[model samples]
Target chain A: MTALAPAASPARTPLGSSIARTLRLGVLRAGYEIRVYFRQADAIFFTFLFPVLLFGIFSVAFSGQGNIGTAPDGSGGISQGAYYLPGMAAAGILLSGVQNLGVDIANERSDGTLKRLAGTPLPVVSYFLGKMGQVLVTGILQLALLIVIARVAFGVELPTDPAKWLTFAWVFLLGIGTSAVLGIAISRLPRRGKSATAVIIPIVLVLQFISGVYLSFTMLPVWLQDVANVFPLAWLAKGMRSVFLPESFASAEAGGAWQLGTVAVVLLLWLVVGIVVSRFTFRWIRKDS
Target chain B: MNNIALPDAVVSVRDLAKRYGAFEALRGVSFDIHRGETFALLGPNGAGKSTTIEILEGYRDRSSGAASVLGTDPQSGGLEWKSRLGIVLQSTGEQGDVTVRDQLAHFASLYPNPRGVDETIAAVGLADKARTRIRALSGGQRRRVDVALGIIGRPELLFLDEPTTGFDPEARQQFWSLVHQLKAEGTTILLTTHYLDEAAQLSDRAAVIAGGELVAIGAIDEIGGAEARVPLVRWTEGGTRHTERTRTPAGTVASLSARLGAEPTDLEIYRPSLEDIYLDLVRENAEAAAAEIDADGPTSPTTRPSATDPITEGASA
Candidate 1:
C-alpha cells in the first residue's frame, strides 16, 4: 500500500466554512471595539461618567420639597432630583447609542479601515454587530451607574416592583436600538466628517434637550413635546418615570405615562427603519462629502 | 498567440473596462496571469494599475468585461474565494492598538489554513519586533507587517502591489528571498511596481501597461530583448580613452589586444541592463502620450461633445 499524504482534513464544505468564518470574525471585531472604548479613556470618561455626575449634582442641589406619585399635588410637580433621574439615564445611555456609534463609524469609513476589510473574510454584519455590542455593554454600565447614584447618593426612590424592572429593561433596550439606528442613519448622510465630534456633540446635546432630557417634556412647547414623543428617548423616559413614579403621577403628554403597546410599536418601527436605512443609506465604507 | 497550456489561469481579465463618468480610467484592458508564476504588471502612475487591482481585489466593480480570480469571478465570488487570495496593497492596512503578533494571530484565524503567527512574523523578518505595536514600527517595519498579513493565510494566489516600496538594500534582498519561498509554494503572484530592477530580479514574466492598455508582455529575458543589441565597451589604451560598440565584446577585446600588442587598459563590457530597457520604455510611453495629445490637440476648450458630435475610445482594444 502507498503511504498517503496528511492534509488539512478538507474544510467541511462551503456552508460550514462560511459559518465558522462569520463567527470568528464577529468575535474578534467585538473584542476590538470594547478595546477601543477602553483605550480612548476620555471617550469613556466623558460619555458615561460625566452624565451620571451631572445627574448627581442636579439631584442633590434640589433635595426633597416635592412629592412623587401625583405631580406633587401641583406643588411644583416634583423634586428636581427625583424628576431628573429618568431623563438623565435616558440622556446618558442615548449618548452611548448615538453619538459614539454614528460619528466614529463615519470617521472609520473615511479613514479607509472599513474598505480594508472588504477583501477579508470578515462578514459586514460582524463589524456593525461589534459596534452594537459595545454600545450594549456601555449602555448596561450607564444603567447601573444611574441606579447606583439615584439610590446611594441622591436617595431617590428605587422601583421595588418586579414590573418596574421589566419595564426598565424593555425601555432601555428600545432606547439603545432606536438611538443606534438613528446614529447609523445619520452616519450615512455624507456630510463632512473631518470635524465629526464637533458636529455630533452639539447635535446629541440638542436632541437630548428636545426629547426632554434636560427639561420636562411638559415644559417644552407642546409642538416640540409632541414631536419628541416620536423618538425613543421620549418613550424611554416615559417608561422609566412610570416605574419610578406611581401611575397617578404619570403625565398625560407621555400618553398616559407608560403605554406598553405604544412603546413597543414605536420601538419596532424605529428598529425597522433603522435596519432599512442602515441597509441602504448607511454607507458603511464610502462617502463623497 | 502562443497556445500556452496554462495550469488554470489564476487571473483572467478579458476586456475589463471601468468608466468613471467622462473620465474613462480603463478601456477594454486584457491580460491573463498563469498560476505558480511571478507575473509583474509594470506601469507608470495613473496608468490604470490601481483601478485594475481594485477590480481584481473585488473592491470595485468593473464597468464591463469579465475578470476572474482563482477560478471565480471576483465581482460575484463572495466570502469563500476572498479567503484564498492574499493582497498586499500599495497603502498600509489599518492597525489597531495591539502587538504585531496578536494582530497577525487574529487575522490568521480568519483564514481556513493560516500559517502559525510566530512563523509568519519570522518570515516577514519581524521576529525581533513581534511584540511592538504597529504605531511604534518604522515605515519599513509597517510595510513588513502589511506583507505578513498578506501571506498569513498561505494564499494560493497573492497580489503584491508595490510590496517593496520602502525596503532598504539588505531588507529588499531579504524580501526577495521571502517572495521566492512563497513562489516555491506554488502561489501565483501578481505584483505591480515602477521598480524595473526589482521586476527583473523577481519576475519570471512581465506585462507593461500604459494608457490603460498592455503595451508589452513576455518572458523577462526575452522582453525588449537585449541580446541582439550590441555591447558597448569602454577603456583607456596607451593613456588615451576610447569607446566602441560591437556585437561580440570578446572579438573587440581580441582585436584591441592585437592592435595594441598588449592588454587594453580599463576594458569593461557594457551590456544594456534591464534599467536601460525600462527607462527607454517609459520614454517611449511618454512620447506616445505626447503624440496622442498632439493628434487630438484640444481643438476646443472642452472635450464635451457638441449636440452633433459624439466621443468614443476610438474603435476598441
Candidate 2:
C-alpha cells in the first residue's frame, strides 16, 4: 500500500439502512448505560430506592385522614393514603426522568464523555435516544416499585377500569417525555460536575412542592397554583392523581373535572419547549460557547 | 512537497481557512497525507493544529478553500464516509463504571466491520484489565482504553490528537509501540502533537504549523531543509563554552584545533536534533507573523511566507 490510503476501505451501509442500524446500535448503548447505572449504588439509591422510601413516609403520615382541600360540598373527601399513591408515583418518574437524567448528563459533559462519543461514527441522535431509553426504562421500574409498595404496605386500592388505565398510560407517557426532554435541556445549566446536584436538587424540591406532589393542589394558595400551572410537574402530578384517585376525588380538583385535555396540552407544550431549547444549547465539549 | 501533486493522496487540502467573526483560526493552510503514511501536525497550543485536524475530521466547518478526506469533502461526508475514519481525542472521556470490553463492543456496533472486542482489548494491552470498570483503571490504562476504542472500527484512517499528553515515560513508550503495530498493519495515522520527539518517532512526514499557517512540510528527517540536518561543533576556551552549527563539523573542529595550536577543552560534536530545528522553526515563524502584524497594522490579516520557502537558512553557520 502507498503512504496515504488503506488497502481496503470500510464497509458502508446504505442511507436507508443507517436509521435501522442506528436504532439497533442505540439499544446496545442503552444496555451499556443501564448496566453502568445498576452498578452504581448512588444512582440506584436516588433513582429507585429513594422514591419508595418517600412513598412509604407519605402514605403512613396521611393514612385514614380525610382530604383537607377542595372536595365537592356533598361528597366526603378521599383518604390521604389513596391520594398520595399517584403523587409518589409521579415523584418517582420526575426524579429519575428529570433530576437524575439532567445531573447524569451534566456530569458526562464535564468529564468529556460526550465529546469522546461524538468523535466516533456513532449516529449522534442515537446517543440521545439511548440515554432517553435508559431513563424511560428506569423511570417505569421506579413507578412500578412505588406502586407495589403503596399497595402492599399501605393497602391502597388500584384503579381496575380500562378507562382509568388508558388515562394512566397517556399521563405516564407524557410525563416521562416532558421530564426527559426537560432533563436534556437543563443539563447544560450546571457549569461543573460538582455543581450539578446543587443546581438540580433545589429545582426538583421546589417543583415537588409547588406541583402538588408534596401538598395537594387544593391545599396550595391560588397564586402558587398559577405559578405551578406554568410548569410540567404540576400537570404531571394532577394527571397521575386523575388516574389513581377514585372518580369522586374529581371533586377536589379544579373545575370539578379530571382536566385530561388540559393535562395533555400542557405536557405537550413542555415537551416541545424542552426539545427546542436543548437543540440550541446542548454541547458535547466543556469549552465555552 | 509544496505542490502535493500525489495521485493517491488520502487527505488533501488547499488554502483551507476557518474564521470565527474577526479572528482567523486557520489561514491558507495546505498539505496532503499520502496513502498509508503516518503524518504529524506539530504545533503549539492555538497554533491551529486541532482546527485543521477537526476540519479534516468533519467535526468543524472551514470558512473557505478545498479539503477532502477519503475522496470526499469532509463538510458533506456522510456516515459512509465517516465509517472509514477513527479518532482518538486528546482527553479520554469514557463512561465510568463500564468495563473495557463493554465500551469497545458498544462502539463496534457503530461500524460495519469492526475488530473483535477481545482482540481489540488485547491490542491495547488491557487484557488483564478488560473486565475492570474504566473508573477503576489508572490514568495510563484509561488512555489505552481510548486507543482501543479508536481502532475497534478497523478504520482505514486514524486520527490521534495528542494521544500521549498525560502519559508517563513508560506508558508513552507503550503507546508508541501500539502505534507502530498499527502502522505495521498498514493503518494510515494522522497524529497531532506538540512533542517533536513524538512526531519524529511516529510520522513519515510532518507539517509544522504556527500562527495558523504552514511553516514547513516534508519528511520528518528532511523538514527545515537538509543543511539543518548538520552537526554542531562545540569547544571551551578560557573556561567559556562556544558552539557552531555547520554541515562539516569535523573540518570545523580540525580548523579550530589548528588555529588554537592546542586541543579545544571539553569539545564535543553533536548532530542538531529535530527538536532544535522544530523550536527554531516555531520561533522564526512567530517572529515573522509578529513583524507582519506590526507593519500591516494590527487588524490587517497576518501574511504567511510562501509554502515552498525553507523555514530558515538552516542550522549551518
Candidate 3:
C-alpha cells in the first residue's frame, strides 16, 4: 500500500481581503441555517406563523366593530383589520428577530454547538452575520404572511404610495436589526437550553403588551404610554401605523402625530444599545471559563 | 522538568495549570509532542485530560503557564493558525437536521486545504450513511461523523479526545487503521483514551496523569520505568501462595524448584502488561496522597488497604 502524503501548506490570503471572505462564509452559513430552521416544526409554528394566526383571530373578532379613527378628509375611518395589521406585522418582526434568535442561540450554546465552532477557524463575526441573515429572511416572510392575510382574507387595504412603502422598508430593517442584536445580547441570560424558552418568552410577551402590539398605545394609561416610549417596539409599531393608517389617525397617537423622525431616532438608539450590550456579553464558550 | 522547548515539537506545554474557583482541575503539567508522533494522554475520569486538550484547542483559556500549538500561543492563535489544527472534542452537541455529507461539506469549506468529503466519509467507514441525517444514525455511526469532521480539514495536527468511546470492537479496529493512516501521512496526533490496548497499539509515546499531575511520560513500552515491568514468579508452597517479583523469572523459578519444590504447585510467571504498570502507578500516587493527608492532620480516618492489594504485598515479598 502506498503511504499517505503530508498535507500541503495552506495558501495565505492577505488580511485586507479577509472581510470579503468573512462575508462570503457568513452568507454560506445563512443558507445552512435556513435549511435547518425550516426543518424544525416548532420554529415554523411559533416564530413564523404565530403572528398570522393572531392576525386572523383579531380580525374576525373585531370585524363588526365600527371604523377605528377618522380620516383628515372627514371620511369614514379604516376597518379593524387595517388598524391591527401594522401592530401584528410589528409583532412578527419582534418574534422572528428577538424571541426566536435568543432561544436558538441559548440552545446552541448549551448543546455544544458553540463549543465546537469556537475550535474552528470560522470568525465569530461571521457566525453572528449568519444569525442576522436568518432573522432577516424569516422576519420578511412573517411580515408578508401577515399582510397577505390582512388584505386577502380580511379585505384590509394596503398602502400603495411609494413614500409609504419607503417608510415601511426602513422600519422593517431597523426593527429586525435592533431586535437581532438584542437577541444575541440576552442569549447569555439562560443557563441551559431547557430554560431558554422560559426566560425569553416572558420578556418578549411583556414587551409586546407594553409596546402597543397587543393594545393600542393611545388607549393605554398616560403613564403606560410614557413607559412604552422607552423601548424600540413602540416606535416600530408606530412607524408601521404611519404607513397603513391615514394622516388623521396620527392625531390619535400619544404625541398627537406619527413623529416618523422620532421613530427613526428611537430605533437607531436601541440598535446602538444592542450592539454595545452584545459586545460585552456574547461568548464563544460558557461563563465557566 | 526541563523548560527548554523542543525545536521540532508541534505541541509544547510547560507548567500548565487550570483552576475553577477552589477546585484545581489541572495542576502544573508539562510535556512535548514532536512532529509525526502519536502521543497518548492516559488518565481516569476527571483527571484533566479533556481540560488540557480544550486549552490546546483554544476552546478554553488556561489559568497559568505556557502552551504553544503549531508554534503559536493558543490563547492568541488567529484563524490562520486555527485552520491548521483539527479538534474532536470529548462530546459535542451537533444538530441532527443535516445529512452527514452536507455537514461535512460545510465544514470542509471553512478550511483552506481540505480532504475530499467522500474520501473522509469512506475513511470513517460511513459511506453507506452519507445521505442519512445524522440524528437517525446509531451512536457508533454518529461518532464516525465526528471523526469525519475532524479530518476533513487536512489538519497537520489532529486532537482526538476519546474518539473511540462508543465504537464496537470491529468499528474500533477500523478506527485504529484510519488513525494509523493519518500517522503515516506525517500528521502529529495527540489522543486521549481509556483503552490501554488502543494506546499501546497506536501511540509511540505516552503520558499518564493522576490528581491533575503528570505521573509518567516516556515511550509507550518504557512508561513507569523498567523497575515497574519486572516479571513475577508465583507458586503454591505448602498451604500458602507466594509471589516474588524479580528481574530474572527463570533463575528465580530454578532456585525455588531446587529448594524442596518439585516444579511447585500452580507455578506461573507473569509479565507486567501496560495495564498492570498503569494501575500500579495510579495506586502508588493515590497512596502517597493519602499519606500526605494523614501527615497533615489526624482529623480524617486512615484509608484501609483492600484485601486484593497484591501489587504492594508482592513487591514487599
RMSD values, in order shown: 6.1, 6.5, 6.0
lDDT of 2 by residue, A199-232 (tens): 9989998999998988878788999999999998
CAPRI-style docking class of model 1 based on DockQ: acceptable
Q: DockQ: which is higher, 1 or 3?
A: 3
> Highest DockQ, which number?
3
Across all candidates, the chain A TM-score values are 0.84, 0.89, 0.93
What TM-score, over all chains together, does every model reach? 0.86, 0.85, 0.91
What DockQ results do all the predictions give, each relative to the true complex? 0.29, 0.29, 0.38
Model 2 chain A: which ten-residue window has the lowest total lDDT? A1-10
In candidate 3, clashing pairs total: 0
Looking at model 1, the pairs that clash are: none
Off by over 4 Å in 1: A1-24, A56-79, A191-195, A245-248, A281-284, A287-289, B1-7, B93-95, B227-230, B235-245, B256-267, B299-317
lDDT per model vs. reference = 0.73, 0.79, 0.85
Tell me how large the interface RMSD of candidate 2 is: 11.1
DockQ for model 2? 0.29
- Can you write out model 3's per-residue Cα lDDT over B47-119, one digit (the tens) per residue? 7787788788886678898999988888888988888889887756666899999999999988877888888
Query: What does chain B score (TM) in every candidate?
Result: 0.84, 0.89, 0.89
